[model samples]
Target: MVDRQYTAWRLYTVLRVRSQDWGGSIVVHQGMDNDGMALAVAANLCGAVFLGLEPDPAQARVVMRAGFCDFLVNTLDEALRAMKNEVRKHRPLTVILEGDAAAHRAEMKERGVYPQLQVIREGEEPIPTGRVEELSAMLATADAAHSLLAMVVTANSNAELRGADRAIAEIIPEGDPRRAWATGAPKFFVREQPPRRYVWLDDPELEAMLAVLPAGLTIEPLSHSAY
Candidate 1:
């Protein structure tokens, strides 16, 4: 337990801390990015239930699939309502609420339940996939974008990537922070676009996925494994 606490503390830079009357602590992070994901995973590993309130359906699907939270509520009211059920589970709880923290915190306290709440604004949307030429044009712009190519394979590709089925087989960069939770079976993958360069080390499926990748941005397969 102490080891786990030390690990989580080392993985995340806690931006703020405050006392809670309910005998828990509040941990704050700047945004719902890699660090936030780390917190959710760490909390669960430490026997705390992690909950997230995300209103965007597309975003919610990604978060849920990644197991970022045990329970995800679409609204503040819904999150507040679920607190008791978490309390009944006899475990520490960590709640991440989107939007204004003050209002949501006040409402939560009014209901006589306090847990470690993570307040954050909406996260940036994934860059839309586009034609190779079109995406290449974006590089010249001030707001350049990049993609994190991830291969998420499922034990059964016929079914959705969920539960024990989904596993991240490979990530192009191979050193991305998001690889912290890579587990499960070999199935299919999803790409978070637009990547500066698409490198293929001989995965036909990954190669096919980037068939339209722009010229000059594709690298030839290198010898020897870097895994």
Candidate 2:
């Protein structure tokens, strides 16, 4: 029964990828071996073009046969030249939901009906419409800047959040002997850096350490603990 269920899931996933219109995009697989070859074959079967970056001549030949790759480039330069003329699709839209939408999202996710829907669940009270507008404005402002940095604060050292490029784990209290060694590395990283836009993430208490960062940084809160 478990095997059957797993097979059903795989079929559903293939169908989902196949249904998408990948007209002006190229799926670039770094190495054309193992899962890389699998992705190339799947993308080709879905009528999508792929670029396999495999240096091995023998392996490249194998993968090329498995799929109709636009460019089986061996180097970054070759890949760039191949993709230089291809047009790309615009960024996709993101749907942000609050309140009772959780149940509906869960149902779709469980049934693999809307496999492309990516959800970010925040356990805090629903954000006000005005606040949402404010956040949108802030995001747009940041987007216009040269660069934007995101920091995620969590108890789990290995915990990774999507869209967060950096992670702050275990905010030790003052006078704790381990505090020095625990946060020492991240200190150099956050201190005295060039002026840049920054955003804080997760637990409020733990993320307060950002306050100590250099005054030149424009730090703002993005979200609270989902717990």
Candidate 3:
């Protein structure tokens, strides 16, 4: 998933690089070779492909679109074949997930996906994105910004509702997401972004983002979580 920590404007800056210009970009489902697959696709000018453990089309589309490229999808079997073909020339896959580079290297070897793993350096190349891919990235970016801004709105305007969760606990339920926010949690229907991997802003950051919004511009709550 595109890093949720990216502010909307920042993500838009990242999204400006279209895959058609770079040839292609990868959207991995569960691993980095998927990015290698993207490299292969870009190198060979092939359409992006997606694979996963889940069968939900909605979820799969979300996973793939994060690469910000046009896609060519199929069954896992087909994806594997395509991946092999696309990734072979691009050995020692480029890993995009953010983490300690050494740990990512160790894990990739443990999984034996790519013995020739090479963590991309800051200057190696920015991950390439496409116009279609921008939609997913933009939405995730804007939604993340919204998540931060909403919390401030909820806290300031709904002070009476603070600590009132217990009264509504039965209606809301334990372990329910809403319970997490003492200030009526902003119900973000996270669809494309991976759960919890994206931005969760601190109060200071939220205050700043909220500050820039036009006065009285309301951010409405969704009735339910987005699937």
Clashes found in each candidate (C-alpha, N, C closer than 3 A)? 5, 0, 5
Error of 1 at 113 (Å): 3.6
Ordered list by TM-score, greatest first: 1, 2, 3
lDDT tens digits by residue: candidate 3, 1-227: 43222232233223223222221233332333333323322222222332222234454455345542234343333344555654544421222233333443344335544312121423332122221232334434434333332322222233322222223333334543333332222122122222221223446544543455334333232332223
lDDT of each: 0.36, 0.33, 0.32
What are the TM-scores, per candidate, against the unseen true structure?
0.36, 0.29, 0.22
Per-residue lDDT of 179 in model 3: 31
TM-score of 1: 0.36
Tens digit per residue, CA lDDT, model 2, 182-217: 332232122112322123233563345565433333
What value does the lDDT take at residue 134 in candidate 1?
A: 19
What shift in Å separates residue 2 of candidate 1 from its native position after superposition?
26
Cα lDDT, model 2, residue 11: 24
Query: Tens digit of lDDT per residue, candidate 1, span 64-119?
Result: 67645555554567665655565556454555556544445455557654444443
Better of 1 and 3 by TM-score: 1
Give lDDT: candidate 1, residue 180: 28
